[model samples]
Target: MELAIILMILLIVVAAAAIKLSDVGLTFPFSKKTNLYTPAERKFLQMLDMAVGDQYRIICRVRLSDIVSIRPNTSVKVSRSAMAQAATKQLDFVLCQKDTMSPVVAVDLVSVEAERSYKAQRDWYVSGALDAARIPHIRIKAKASYKPQEIRDCIHAKLAPLRFQQPQEPLVRGTLNNDKAPLRRPVAA
Candidate 1:
């Protein structure tokens, strides 16, 4: 009879503990926020919109992974590690064809202030990758004011060559020449 009474008390203690634990639900006190863009970014975006006019679309915070891939024609296989590294990097902006959303250029807004070595290294990597991909990349300094004409000229300079060049074959069919280098800039199509 005593053992039965002890067993019943133990059961009640366990049940009480379980109930107490269950009462402590997880929650956060966060609320929805607005205006994700910073003041400088907003200003630059305005200038960029005016400069490009209706010819191209300006997209912000584009992932590098979306812009590049291990070319399909390459005999070399991209390792999982390489892809994971690429996924982490992102571009500040991408200028695309308005109707087709084809990326025409990639832009990075850099501060004149001294940055950490790692950030500089990452920037170098991004630049090299974009260059290899034959995607024109512009590095703009974060500035108090911008000249729309200058910006327009910069975009035009890069795009003018592409606009004139005619490709003999589609980009997908081009084969990779080596393991170390990226596929040759798709024969100007």
Candidate 2:
């Protein structure tokens, strides 16, 4: 009977350590492990960090309007230039590259719509086109002047077919930069 009570007490203690204890408000008991980002992922994160900067969170919703894939169709063959021109055209303003897959764009619809709405909506499509084109609204606004439904449909159509998987950076085989800086010195080998 004493052995059974001791075993029961040990099991309860182990369970308490694994789960959230009511004594602590909303605190889980497990130790966490963190994974680090790769160089390319770090660069991408840096760009996003630059774009969004101190605004860690935005209050407005964003939607991607449309995307057209650009290809290198014409080759300058007469000169026999064998270089498969590595000139990469700008894909989009906000893009997230997936592992072994094409990147996805996240457009700033709030900025886009706000800019268009401020211009009185129809200015871009009509005889107001010339005036609107010169006003700098086009640059700040979305490519397609979309309605609520249009924005929803556009994103659904574009993203529905694409599958986003976890980024694989070959499981970084080195120690982390303790100071969170890019400057790496020779560690004692």
Candidate 3:
């Protein structure tokens, strides 16, 4: 009887407190983000699109874990630690094959000052991990403007070996020797 009354009063008090907090706007205070990319990043994304054209798909703000994983042979503890670390770190952009969606290149946009500071520690880890996985990492200096052709040239140069490994189609239907037959004009003379 007495115990039941006290329990009922306590429950009502707790519920009242929660309702008051909600009425005061203390719950669900978050709002939607306005923009996904900063102005500089937006500009670079446009330039990257122009540079790669239809050759590759561009993924922005990719997590390291999405690109690489801990070895299967690793112990549980080490794997947990590696995953935790990878989950927090992210790459600025990743270029993937359009057909297979396999990540081929990782790009990081860094300011001159960030490159020289403690941020370099993060870069070192990202570089080592990508290197171990045999993925090419390209660091680009963020600036006000970029030339798409230069970006294309740089990407092609790095991907030269990959391009050679893939089978290429002939430019013409037949062999070059047969494509154009030489004329024997002096036979009649």
Q: Give the whole-model CA lDDT for all candidates, comma-separated.
A: 0.80, 0.38, 0.85
Which pairs in model 1 have colliding backbones?
A: none
Q: What is the per-residue lDDT of model 1 for residues 23-62, given as tens digits with 9 covering 90 to 100?
A: 7754465787688687877888888999999999999988
Question: What shift in Å separates residue 29 of candidate 2 from its native position after superposition?
Answer: 60
Regions more than 4 Å wrong, model 1: 1-29, 73-79, 117-122, 167-189
Cα error of candidate 1 at position 55, Å = 0.6
Output the number of the TM-score-best candidate.
3
**TM-score for all predictions?**
0.69, 0.19, 0.73
- Candidate 1 lowest-lDDT run of ten: 113-122
Badly placed stretches (over 4 Å) of model 3 are 1-11, 18-26, 113-122, 161-189
Residue 162, candidate 2: Cα error in Å is: 3.0
Clashing pairs in 3: none
Give lDDT tens digits, candidate 2, residues 1-189: 999999999999989886756558676787755645434333434444455444333111112112221225745572133222212111123433333223243433222345445333333232132222221111223343334444334444545544334455765676567787765678998
Ranking by TM-score: 3, 1, 2
lDDT of 2 at 115: 42
Error in Å for residue 102 of model 1: 1.1
Candidate ranking (lDDT, best to worst)? 3, 1, 2
